[model samples]
Target: MESGPAIFAGTTFALFGAGLLLWTGARVLHREPVALGVRPSVSLISATLSGVVFLALGVWCFGRM
Candidate 1:
């Protein structure tokens, strides 16, 4: 069984992941602002990639449960 710290860490990771996923979804729905540091396509691609990474991390953390 996992210890308290591991579980806590996992929850944290999952929360961050969920937040990123929400942002991506909102962006997709055009309810959120687009990325602004670079070209439009590049910003979008980076945001998408980041969202994927966050989601993966969250799932991995949740798996620890």
Candidate 2:
């Protein structure tokens, strides 16, 4: 059923979303450019927005089940 696809896709989306949010926090908090391979001027606001969107999308998918 479509529920199967939703669970699989939603799980994947959530995994990456959590990883992204965690990475963003590490980058912003640690300020280690080498760790994240990002520039010092990286925008935290955008990162937060993207992470939130993905997480919300993932949750919505799971809710469809």
Candidate 3:
């Protein structure tokens, strides 16, 4: 069985990643602001990638458990 902390961490990571992806998609599609001191396209791509990484990490954690 997984420890409580591990489960909590995995859940948090997954939820944050999902939320980030949704927010990024909504902002990009709606032409809303997404500032990161870089071009909009670059920011969008980076944010999307980060979300993917977080989601992958969360999955990895759960798999380990």
Q: Give the worst 10-residue stretch by lDDT in candidate 1.
A: 31-40
lDDT of 2 by residue, 1-65 (tens): 87999999899888888988999888777765523455555567667777888888899999999
lDDT of 3 by residue, 1-65 (tens): 55677788888889989999999999988998666578998888889999998888888778777
Clashing pairs in 3: none
TM-score of each: 0.63, 0.79, 0.87
Record all residue pairs in model 2 with backbone atoms less than 3 Å apart, i.e. clashing: none
Candidate maximizing TM-score: 3
Clashing pairs in 1: none
Q: Rank the candidates by lDDT, best first.
A: 3, 2, 1
**Better model by TM-score: candidate 1 vs candidate 3:** 3
Model 2: residues >4 Å from true position, as ranges?
A: 33-42
Winner of 1 and 2 under TM-score: 2
